[model samples]
Target: MSHSAEHGRVRAGYNAVAEDYQKQIGGELAHKAVDRALLGVVVEAARGGLVADLGCGPGHVAGWLAKQGASVVGIDLSPGMVEIARREHPAAEFREGDLLRLPAADGEFAAAVALYSVIHLEPGELRPAFAEMRRVLRPSGTLLVSFHLGTEVRRLDEWWGHPVAIDFHFLESERVAALLAEAGFTVEARLEREGLPEEAATRRGYLLARRDAG
Candidate 1:
C-alpha cells in the first residue's frame, strides 16, 4: 500500500481503539520501572525545558513528564488519540501531527521522546521520521526512542475486536543507532530489556541520542 493509505489505516485503527489503547497502555509506566527510570534520565538531560512527546497516545508520557516538572507537548497522528490525550492531560498541549512531517518549528523543542512510536513506521520511513525529530530539536537536544527489538513486522487485522489494519515493525538496536547517527544525532546510550508478562514476548530497545551542536 502507499504510505498515505497505510497511514490512513493506522489513524483509523487507533481511532477505533483509542479507549482500549488508553486502558491497556496509558498507565503502563507504573508497572515498568525500567522505562520510568530511563525517562527520568531523558527529562534530566532535557534541562527541564519544553519537550515533545511524539506519538503520545492518551498523553500518558506527557502527563508523567509534566508531573516531573517539565513542560511537554504530546503529538500524534490520530485525531482520536490527540483528543484522548487532551482530555487525559489538560495541562499539556496535544496536537495531531505526523512524525515524518512534524508541525513544530525548527529547533523548537529542547528534547523529544518517541517511545514505541517508531514501531508504526515502516523500515523505509525511519530516516525521514528521525530527521523530522532532529529538525525540531535544539542544538545539543536529547532524544529518547523506544521500540520493539527484532526484524519482524506484525500486522494486526483487528484490535479489541475492532476490524482494522496496522503493522508494527520491530527493529534492531544497532541499525537504529546508525539511523540516528545519519540523522545528525550522536548516540549516547542503548538498552534492551525483556518485555513484561502482559506485553508481547519480545525484547524492547531504547536509545538515547543527542543532536549535534553544529
Candidate 2:
C-alpha cells in the first residue's frame, strides 16, 4: 500500500478503537515505574519550555507530564483519540497531526516523546520521521522514543472487537539509534527491558537522544 493508504488505515483503526484503547491503556503508566522515570527525565530537560508528545494516544502521558509542571502538547493521527485526550486531560493541549508531517513550527519544542509511536512507520519511513521530529525541536532538544524490540511486522485485522487494519513493526535498538543519528540526533542513552507481565510478551527498547547543537 502507499504511505497515504497505510496512514489512512492506521487512522481509521485507531479511531475505531479510541475509546476502548483509552479505557484499557490510559492508566498504564501507573504500573510502569521505569516509563515514568524516563518521562521524568524529559520533563527536567524541558526546563520550562514546551514539550510535544508526538503520537500521544489518549493524552495520558501528556497529562502526566503536565502534572509535573511541563508545558505539554499532545499530537495524534486520529481525531477520535485527540478528542478523547482533550476531554480526559484538559490540562494539556491536544491536536490531530501526522508524525511524518507534524503540525508545529520549527524549533517549537524543547523536548519530544514518542512512546511506542514509531512502531507504525514502515522501514523506509524511519529516517524521515526522525528528521521531522528533529525539525520541530530546538537545538539540543531532548527526544525519547520507545518501541517493541525484534524483527517482525505484526498485522491486526481486528482489534478490541473492532474491525480495522494496522501494522506494528518491531525494530532493533542499534538500527533505530543509527536512524536517529542520521537524522541529526546524538544518542545519549539506550535501555532494553522485558515487557511487564500484563503487557504483550515482547522486549521493549528505549532511546534517549538530543538534537545536534550544530
- Candidate with the greatest lDDT versus the true structure: 2
lDDT of 1 at 154: 95
CA displacement after TM-score superposition, residue 35 of candidate 2 (Å): 0.3
- Which digits, one per residue and each the tens of the lDDT, describe model 2 over residues 135-185? 999999999999999999999999999999899999999999999999999
What TM-scores do the predictions have?
Answer: 0.98, 0.99
lDDT (10s digit) by residue, model 1, range 102-131: 989999899999999999997889999999
Off by over 4 Å in 2: none
Query: Could you tell me how far off, in angstroms, the CA of residue 56 lies in candidate 1 after the best superposition?
Result: 0.5
* TM-score of decoy 2: 0.99
User: What Cα-based lDDT does every candidate model obtain?
Assistant: 0.92, 0.97
How many angstroms is residue 4 displaced in model 2 relative to the true structure, after the best TM-score fit? 0.4
